[model samples]
Target: MKKLILALAVLVSLSAAAQRSQDKKKMDAFITNLMKKMTIEEKIGQLNLVTPGGGIATGAVVSSNVEAKIKEGKVGGLFGVHGPEKVRQAQDFAVKQTRMKIPLLFGSDVIHGYKTIFPIPLGLSASWDMALIERSARIAALESTANGLNWNFSPMVDIARDPRWGRVAEGAGEDPYLGSQIARAMVRGYQGDDMTKPTTMMACVKHFILYGAAEAGRDYNTTDMSRIKMFNEYLPPYKAAIDAGVGSVMSSFNDIDAVPATGNKWVLTDLLRGRWGFDGFVVSDYTSVNEMIAHGMGDLQAVSALALKAGLDMDMVGEGFLTTLPKSLKEGKVTEKEIDQSCRRILEAKYKLGLFDDPYRYIDTSRPAKEILTADTRKAAREIAARSFVLLKNNNQVLPLKKSGTIALVGPLANNKNNMLGTWAVSGDPQTSIPLLEGMKNVAGNGVNIIYAKGANITNDTLLAKKVNVFGTRIDIDKRSPEEMLKEAVEAARKADVVVAAVGEASEMSGESSSRSDITLPESQKKLVRALVQTGKPVVLVMMSGRPLALEEENELTTAMLQTWHAGSEAGNAIADVLFGDYNPSGKLTATFPRNVGQVPIYYSQRTTGRPATSEEFKKFQSNYLDVPNSPLFPFGYGLSYTTFSYGDVKLNKNSMKPNEAITATVTLTNTGKYDGEEVVQLYIRDVVCSITRPVKELKGFQKVFLKAGESKEVSFKITAEDLKFYNSELNYVAEPGDFKVFIGTSSQEVKEADFKLQ
Candidate 1:
């Protein structure tokens, strides 16, 4: 019987191996045959993915004759078009009219969600729960695939620190270690283990080559940084996504060292493909290739050849490849082999997407109504939205508002459903969303009288409103003047014991193309909040924003403040749940909120200078800002709970560690206050000395713990050499033998420390 079982097991393993071998052989033969029949023009066309004019205008190029081009086999893929019916129509045109009958790939910027929106990427990162983050992506994939989108331009893994950069709201926060982890999680969620699954979409790690480090926190600005800084702080997440086998990469619009990322060979070929072995297609970010002309990198043809030769596989939106590549090939500027290679990569991606096997796999019109924006999806959005709210302050335990009280909800976003969905909410239905007014009414019940007023417009300027409403109408100005609005808000504040002031930038004010030179609260809204504070009522400030704002005055004047970044469909209900003791606030700040815009690029993991500013007293030679304090308004991992929590001294299992050995660090946390709460127990490490300079503190590990009132729990973390590795001057990641400090605490500023030596 044992011999028979062994034979059966061997037969099963052999059958699996045979299947894989056959699949590889089939793919190779298919590509070889297709390449032989393809002309240089056809090959270049296959490398061109474009968006159409009739659909949503996500970028500069929207082809006027999409149908004619698809029939001529001049376009390989399409993006920006949503809905199953529309996608099916495009796919039908490609399959039936084109000579090759090759299926066209459909991609979309489904960053956070498709129909039922989740929190923005930065807010999602604050959860620090990999499974939850992955689950959010999975749901996004499911919804997108059901709506005929097989590719997602998502998991924006750019490591950013400056809150002034509008796109900072779209990526993982400052630290490379955490950013890489989140990048991998998002990729896994989007692609899943089985890319052939109909519900999954191809994951594209985006804005390659440091788009986050835009100078002066302005969008589309030139970016310049050393290669060492790139490898050490910025490049890890992209590498992590590549390691996770992401299907594609989107080049950034910013220039790296005077060269645009889309045309830079060192970044696309040498670093990404040759070094990292990323066997995927590289797409240009919305006409970034043609924009290179503006960067003084020669004309369109020159830039096209440079991009194609540099290993860029697909030209997104930019017709530069389609219009100039043929001329380049004939002129010997671009070899035919380069075109063939790019075409093969695109074909390989299509094959991986299983498009050749079933061109109509994701085109089911019924699925949209049945699966998109359903009750289950809204519930998931609410759960994630609740998790994204970072409690900035809870002085005197002002939060968890008593369920039976007159709560005055004042400000622009208090009852506004349009802004609840936040920025980059493509296909998300705002009408279905619960506004802050509705959420409070639901949570407080009929017994609680809720007085509401629109404090002020998001911004008083008309030009600002026009720019912010690029996608849709966000700010609706009332006929009442600013003074009248303030008077009404003050009246509401006088009537209620507690005032919930919902104020921040408009939903469209801080996203991809929405950058602000000044990141403080709009003057109109700040005046309204100041007036409410004078009413002598305790105010719970609920800020709705996409990026972190400079809230120096708000922090001091408000009794409690919640950084509720554009929570999707159920934004109001989720905020109300926390405010009324239904749900405990657990969200922590992923990005540091700067005290002032002058203190830009401030993060907890910054390197210690040779003359570090150790004392509050400033010296002329020290690394200290003369105008502002060298501290963020709220540090990374900083959050407040309804109840206070206390931390004990650090307990180490050993004082010394051998090479490649692990050590245990533990701390006791007690919820000393009257209510239950959740705390993020952060663990940071510092190498005292190294061959090269090191960060003052690097977040190595963290665990979010929940406890009832007066409950005590021990939180422990295991540390290894992997946690200590950093990119040296040579750009090689290694751990050096040295003395290390292990700091465990609630936030980066407050910590208990211990020392150990590693040899």
Candidate 2:
């Protein structure tokens, strides 16, 4: 019977391999026939991705003569434009007017959610639920495709440690393991199983190499790190995305190892394509190919040739390829084969998207009303937003505010809808978003009296406001004086039994080029918080930010604090649900919150040094900060629920295992508090000895389990030798026989440890 079953499995596997080979042959033949008739100009045009100036332009320039270029077959793809009608018009020019009659691929940054926005990527990561994260991406793909988009630039998988880097809001935080898992989930969500599906858009994993680890946490700054560090710490997420079948990649604006990522052959070719076997087309981040000229890579024509040779398939919003690639080819600086290969990749992408078969596959015009921002999508957004919120602090159980209380809803974001949708929500409409006051009223009902006050403006600095307001008026300064605003908030707090201060960064304060040196509350809002606290009222601070903030002062002042990462569209409703106890806050902190800006790149997974600080206290020559402690204000994977959970000691099925064998680790988690809640049970492992130094602890596995009050559940994780593997000094991925410590915990810090070994 076993032999018969094995024979059947072999047959099935053979059949699958044959089918894949057949499919590849068909694709290659189709592209070859198409390319044979294409001229040099047209082939180079296939590498040109132009964005018409309707949506957001991250770069300085939008494409000029876009319609004429598309009609002339000088443009391969179009982004920054949506809607079925608009996309159909763009596609018509490519297919109808162009000589080759090729279809134009439509792309968009469908990051979190489309139209019906969810929380930022950082907040989404906080949920620690891969299924939920995948669902969010699925919904985004559905909505984006409904609006005629076949490609999505999302799942920015850069593993960020520094909260100062604004784009941290756009990624899964810190840990490569968690980031890699989310990357896979997001890719699966966006692309689904088949790219040919009209509802499934192609997912683009972005910022190709180490854009998050910019120097001094500045945006678009240079990145330098060892190859070992890259493989072990930063490269995992991008690898995971590629492994999950992401259709495309976007190169970062920053340079790697002093070479611009757009022109770095070692990274783009040697590592990504050669090592990882990524077959996807590579697109440069908004004019990044052109910007390489500034990186001393030479003129436009020179850099264009460099990028093509480096394996970058498409130039985004930059006419560098359109204007200079033909010149480079004529000068023999770039080969016709290199150009052909790049064009072939882009054409393959279009073919996979089913664009070649039917240019208008995604253009229904009817899908928008039925699928976009519908009641179901909004409900999902609200539910997702609630789960994305982290209960930073809840001293004396001050949260789960009574529905009957007279509550003071105060701060710049209290009644404001403008900042609800966080950064990079290019498609979200602020007017459609629910404000905090409105949400409180809707959730609290007639039994509760909700008095509102604009405590202060998001910031008093007009210079900073101008930079952030490039897209829209995110930080709107009020007409009233700061003193008057504070007085009004204090008066409201006195009248109410409790205060809910909605404060933090405006939507544009932390994304793309919005990095901050001091990641703390603006003075205007800080004063408002201080005044409200002085009212002697129990304050429930609803903090909205794109990045993890330094809230040491506010933590001491507020009775309760919730870190809501600019909850989108239904931000108000979601905040109200958590505050009113309709949904318990289960979102953990993906990134660590620093006590101050001094601890810029603080994270839980640092490699142990010979002179490592044993505790918070300072010691001579020890790796410790003199002023601040060696710990973060809020550690990664830290979150609190209305209910309290107690974890039992970890129990392992075996103390040692062979390379091929697996072990099991189990822990009893009990809900000791009065409320039912969900807890993210995190598993971490440390290699006691190895070929090279390893992180003190690395997250290996996790499970989000739900328990009712007083209920206990045994959570187990299957551990294998594969989980113990890491890249050594020689850059070989292997697991050496060594002692290991396994930790099962709520957060990285608070955990029960058990010892094990791999033999």
Candidate 3:
């Protein structure tokens, strides 16, 4: 029977391989024949992707007459525009009016979800449940594909340690290993097994090569880091996305080393394609190809040619190739062969999407009512949002609030539905979101009284508020003064048995170009929170932001603190679920929440410093800060549940093992506190010695397990030499025989360590 099963497996594998070969041949033949009939202008047009009016314009559209361009065969794709009626109109123009009838690809920043919004990517990563993460992407793909989108600029995958980079909210946090896992899951979820399926869209793993490591945690800033650092930490997630069969890549706006990522052949071609073998097309970030001039690379034509040589296949919103590539080709800077190669890649992607067969495959206007923001999708969003929320503190059992009591729901965000869907909810409707006031009322019975007050404005910083309002009026000044608002909140808290302060950033504060230097609760909200606390009530602070905020003071002040992280569409309902003990939060912090902004880039996987401080004790000569301790307000993988979990000492199968052999690390986790809960049992590994210095620790594996009260489960992880592999001085990935340490923990900082050796 085993032999028969093996034969069947081999047969299935061969059949799939044969199908892939045939599909590739068919795509090549189709593109080759199409290119043969195409003129130079037409070919360059196929490489140009533009944003039409009435879409989420990230940058100024270089060409506003996108419909005319499509008619002229000068536009290959349209993004920023969603909805079937508009997309079909654009598709109809490309098919009926264009010279070649090339169907334009419709792309969008479908980062989390389309219509039915889910949590931000960072918040999704906090769940640490790969299946759940993948399902979120799957649901996102289903809804997006139904709404005329064939591509997604998602699964940002860039490993971010600096929370100050506003785009940090878009990526997996800090650790390369965990980021890689999430990257693969997102890829699988977005692309699924077939690109041609109507439920899936092409996944574009974005910001290629370390955009997350922007200097001083600023957006689009120059990122200068050692190659060793790149391969070990930053590059892994992109590579993982590639390995998982991501269909496209979006080049970042930042420079890698000295060269901008959109025009770096060494990074894009030599490494991404040649080394990693990513066959998918590469799209430039909005106007990134033309922005090469800002990088001082060359003239418009020169940069266009340079980006082409650097393996950029599509010029998104720049029209660089359409306007300048032909000029560059005539000047003998870029060859026709290079242009053909890129055009073919784009054509092949469309073919894989089955767009060539039916240009209007995604243009079903009827799917919106049937598929978009359905009850099922909203339920999924609510469930996922609940899992995405991280419980930072639950001192005095302040959470799991009794549903029968008088609860004061206070803050700018308490009743505001506008900011509930978080930052990148391009297609999400704010009206669909349930506000905290409504959610609490719904969750509590008639026996409960839910009082509410807009305790403060989203923020009081004039300059900051002005900037945040660029996208929309998310924050409006209250008619009542801050003092009056606080008085109302205090009175509400005084009347209630418990207080829930719904406060944090508005939706626009932590997305693209929204970096924050001081990542703490706004002073107005802080004052409000302090006032509520002074009312002598047990207060639960609910933070709603896209990135991790420093909550050292709040952690000390509040009876409980929850990181809601701008959870999308169903934010209020999900928060209410946790508050009312309907769901136990199992989400963990994927990024380090520093005690203060001074510890900006602090992560769990930093190298052992030459003069490492032994403890928080101030060692004057050591690598230590004078005023602040080198500890995070809340460490990565740190989250609390209504019930407490106790992890037993890590047990290893062997003290020593051969490089080929695997070591099994096991830990028994018990739900020591009352109530059923879930715990993410994390497995972290450390290389004590290596070819070069290694990080203090790296997250290797994790398991999310559910345990009822008094129930214990043994979580085990298999660690092979592959888990120990790292890029050495020569940039060769290898595992060195050395002493290693394995940590089994609930969080990175609090762990039980066990040492082992590799032979």
CA deviation > 4 Å runs, candidate 1: 1-25, 55-64
Candidate 1 local lDDT, 256-375, one digit each (tens): 878889999888999998999998899989998999999999999999999998888899888899999888878999998888888998898888889989999888888888888899
- lDDT, candidate 3, 287-308, per-residue tens: 9988999899988888999999
lDDT (Cα, tens digit) per residue for candidate 2, span 1-759: 999999999999999999989988999999999999999999999999987784334422234478889888899998887888878878888899999999988898988988999999999999999999999999999999999999999989998999899999999999999999999999999999898898999999988999999999999999999999999999999999999989999999898888999999998999999999989899999999889999999998889889989999999988899899877888889999999999999999999888888889999988999999999999999999999999999998888999896999999989888899999998889899998888988898999988899989999999999999998899898898988988999999999999999999999999999999989999999999999999899999999999999999999999999999989989999999999999999999999999999988899999989999988889889999888898999999899999999999999999999999999999999999999999999999999998798899999999999999999999999999999999988899999998999999999999999999998
Q: 666 in model 2: Cα distance from truth in Å?
A: 0.6
| lDDT values, one for every candidate | 0.87, 0.92, 0.89
Question: Which pairs in model 2 have colliding backbones?
Answer: none
List candidate 2 stretches off by more than 4 Å. Answer: 1-11, 54-64
CA displacement after TM-score superposition, residue 197 of candidate 2 (Å): 1.3
Weakest lDDT window of 10 consecutive positions for candidate 1: 55-64
Candidate numbers, best lDDT first, in rank order: 2, 3, 1
